[model samples]
Target: MASNTSLSSLSILIALLFLTNCQAARHLLEETPEVESPPHPTIPTLPKPELPPVPEEPTIPKVELPPLPVEPTVPKVELPPLPEIPKVELPPKPSIPSIPKVELPPVPSIPKVELPPKP
Candidate 1:
């Protein structure tokens, strides 16, 4: 059929394209040369600067002060006592009723038919 021939021709064209791509990749890998990378430059080290020493603090003379006077004591005020509250009683909760169980009928069995033997 014409459809079968067209399909075969399409498959052959795809196969040729794949083969050409593979051949080009192989040729590029074989012909390309490896390049060397440049070396990194070295950095110079700098010397640290020295600082001058700090001067010592000057000595100060101490002076004596007079003692403070004693403070007077304060009297505390008495407060009245609070009255007691009365206790309250609550009623008991009601009970829930029980449900009865239900009974189901038995299922019937199906009958089987026997077939004749083939000749």
Candidate 2:
């Protein structure tokens, strides 16, 4: 929010500067009618100077590179056979014991709460 305020203030300042510059320019122009009027100072004709031609780019000689050496063939290495892993047998899981059900007594009912009539 603070950034937005600063941005808006900056924009307003720029607009004010632009308006002030325009007003000053208009007043100056109005004050100098004679200078702005007839026979605008003729732009003095300047002689067109001849520019020297650009020099041609030098040609570079092509460099010949030596051929790359051939790679040597690698001999096939025989690896030793891996030993077989022995299988391990696990014991069977034991059965869970059954739990006995118990009978619960019934819950007593709550008595009604009575309120006296308001006067």
**Which candidate should be chosen as best, given TM-score against the real structure?**
1
Cα TM-score per model: 0.36, 0.35
**How well does candidate 2 match the true structure in TM-score terms?**
0.35
Residue runs of model 1 more than 4 Å from their true location after superposition: 1-26, 54-72, 85-119
Steric clash pairs (candidate 2) = none
lDDT of 1 by residue, 18-61 (tens): 99999999999999998777998888888988878888889887
lDDT of 2 by residue, 24-109 (tens): 99999989757455676778999999999999999999999999999999999999999999998889889899999888899999
lDDT of each: 0.87, 0.92
Q: Worst lDDT window (10 residues) for model 1? A: 86-95
TM for candidate 1 is: 0.36
